[model samples]
Target: MATSAVPSDNLPTYKLVVVGDGGVGKSALTIQFFQKIFVPDYDPTIEDSYLKHTEIDGQWAILDVLDTAGQEEFSAMREQYMRTGDGFLIVFSVTDKASFEHVDRFHQLILRVKDRG
Candidate 1:
């Protein structure tokens, strides 16, 4: 039997940014995905980041997920992080209509900052 070794340093990193309105379960979704736990309480996040080594499409890669603050006060920092993200997960709470409606805003922001438009 033979084993092939993959170079650790050469592994591609995918940066995913989670964005949404406050209390929209952005942190909860991020924490659950990274830590495998459900947090019922809502704690406003300024910013949080998680890194993991995982296999994607049968190839190993580094997953860098940024959990961002959804508060208006943190809006200033949105562009800073958005500029660094390769992709984004726009989260919204099903129970909160406002959060759902603002999804377009977040999407637009990401596009504007990323210059994807």
Candidate 2:
């Protein structure tokens, strides 16, 4: 007799998407969160994924973190990421007023795409 392998029910998975304006440190923040190292330079992100297995409040889960591009040039790709994400980290440069403005736009778009109002 042949046996089938099934995924463990105890394993939980999560997708976290990082969104923000260019040069706002989105990649740096995501990297630092799991690696504890600070990146001192700026680089444009096309798309990047980082995986980490973690336990929170005694519950085990795997996090698939998606670091995304911050430029409007990549806006067309944002909705795809937004839809697949279980959660989002919206970011903006504190010292740059324009980035703050973009944050609002990003938030609205996420709400709209996720149909959350």
Task: Give every collision pair in model 2.
Answer: none
Candidate 1 residues 28-67, lDDT tens each? Answer: 9988998899999988999999998878777878999999
Whole-model lDDT values for every prediction: 0.90, 0.88
Candidate 2 positional error at 29, Å: 0.2
Error of 1 at 12 (Å): 1.0
Alpha-carbon RMSD, candidate 2: 6.7
Runs in model 1 deviating more than 4 A are: 1-7
TM-score for each of the candidates? 0.90, 0.87
Q: Which parts of model 2 are misplaced by more than 4 Å?
A: 1-10
